[model samples]
Target: MTSIEIRHNLFDNPEVSGTEYKTVELIIKKLQIYHPDILTSDIKDGHGVIAIFKGKKQGKNIAFRTDIDALPSGHRCGHDGHTAILLQFAEYIVSGNRPETGSIILIFQPEEETGNGAKKILQSKVLQNLHVDYIFGLHNLPGYHLGNILFKYGTFAAASTGFIAKLEGKQAHAAYPENGINPAKAVADFILALDSFKNDDISNFKQITVIHVNIGEIAFGTAAGDANVMLTLRSFTNKGMSELINNVTSELQQLANKYSLKVSYDFQDKFNALENDDVCVDIVKAAAKELNMTTESLPEPMRWSEDFADYCLKWHGGFFGIGSGENCKPLHNPEYNFPDELIDIGAKMFLKIAEQAMVD
Candidate 1:
């Protein structure tokens, strides 16, 4: 099947993180046709697929990966296209321009949106048995010239985690509100205190975005005894993110104590900052140059999070971006659709990177 066909198939039947069964099944079916030397769909949770092609002569082993799960809703994020690109590159390896030395591993990784897939893959028996020398991956970036290559030497993305604070107190009739402790004031104070943690310094960037807040029910006769505040915290480096978490948690406990409210904290979807290997990054730039592709260097790391950070931390690799278009819709927008033209550019880019890595 063609790459565009594979992309459309994934788009028509999208799956979210932690529930990528159909996506895995379809990828396995297409990859079987390419006849990789070794193919696996049963590693760990069996929600992702791995295909391996070996060269006749022994050399370095390189791997390329793509996030396969779509967002929880709206079918945004361009993951379907990412999967198609890797699948197309796999097909090319079998049909033409086979690597003269070393091996190629195409990893269709699931649960990237939930920040669990890469860790799971790292622990999988399949990956543990194979030693990979160099690795690479990419994301589609909107608001740039279509097919342009965008990269950064150090970090490509930021570290981020979700925060949930639940407050509990005594409830009472609204008329006699003094009869019980109310948490409304505490919740308000907590949110305002969170603002003190926000900063945009390029050297030490940090951010706290409130995603949700809840304060009891709408019944006017009753005083709210419980409330919740949900936020996403980000930083340019892993150490900075840890500091942000520590400071916020300490202040949050103080607020709970001051208001005599029982508070609990829950953190979710933690992603480390993606720090690119300098050598791997240079290989990507060289590959793009070899292909005569337009390239742009990012002035700073992106404020977004990526689980691919997990792989880069475990091994040497770099993550780059493929421009979708200046007018393309922003990711996570309900109207967003991955530009189909990116399939060829991204797949060919991976091919060139594989060629460059075999000799590096």
Candidate 2:
């Protein structure tokens, strides 16, 4: 099948994070037809597919990963395009355009939107047994010029975690408010304290945003006895994030004690900051130069978080961005869609990188 057709097929049938059974099935079917050499759809616990293409002479085992899961809002993140790029690249490898030496592994990872897919894949014996020497991945950037490649040397993205704080107190009758405890004041104070955790330092890149707040419901006759706050915390470094989390926890505990309320908190959607290896980044630049494609070096790391950081941490690799178009809608926006033109561009880039890795 053509790359465009495959991309549309994956985009039309969207699956939310953690449930990509049909997506995996379709990917496996295509890989079997195109590559057929090494394909594994072995479902143990996590959802993912691995395809290996061995070359004439073995040198280094290089892997390229692409996320296969879509957001609850649908394929607004362009994972469909990413997956199609890898699939087409696989087709290129198997159609006698194999690397001169070494092998290539294509990974279709699941649940990336939930921030646990890469971790689960790494833990699974499937990837651990491959012993990949180098890994690479890419995401499409909507605001850049079409076909332009963007690279960063270190800290490509931020470390982030979803913070949730809950408080409980005794409800009080409206007529006699002092008879029981009310948590409204505690919630208000906690919000203020949480905001205080945001460091204004430009280098640290720390931020705290309150996403949700809830107090006891609408029956106006009773004072609110319980409250909760949901926040997203981010930093450029893990140390900075740890410090912010510790400070927030300490302040929240103090506020709970002062207000005489029971308190509990938990974190979700945790992501480590992405640090790109300098050597791997040079390979991307060289590949772009070889293709005569435009390239840009970002001045600062993106505030968004990506699970690809997990793979880069384990292997000496780099993750870069491909431009969708200058006027295209941003990722996760309802109007956003992956452009069909990027399929060939991304696939060629990955193929070039694989060739370079084989020779280097």
Instruction: Give the candidate number with the greatest TM-score.
Output: 2
lDDT of 2 by residue, 99-120 (tens): 6667788889998888998888
**Candidate 1 clashing pairs, residues 3+ apart or interchain:** none
How high a TM-score does candidate 2 get?
A: 0.94
Estimate, for each residue in 1-360, the C-alpha lDDT of model 1 and write its tens digit. Answer: 688988999998998887889888889899888888889986687498888888898888899999999886736999999999998888778878777787898888988888999988778777887889988999999988999999899889999999998999998999999998899998888889887887889889999999999998899999998998999999999989999998888888898899999989999999999999999999999999999999999889989999999988878988999998999998888888999999999989999999988878
* lDDT of candidate model 1 versus the reference: 0.90
Ten residues in a row with the worst lDDT in model 2?
A: 35-44
State the lDDT at 163 in candidate 1.
94
Which segments of candidate 1 are over 4 A away from where they belong?
A: 72-74
Which sections of candidate 2 miss by over 4 Å? Answer: 56-58, 200-202
**Overall local distance difference test of candidate 2:** 0.87
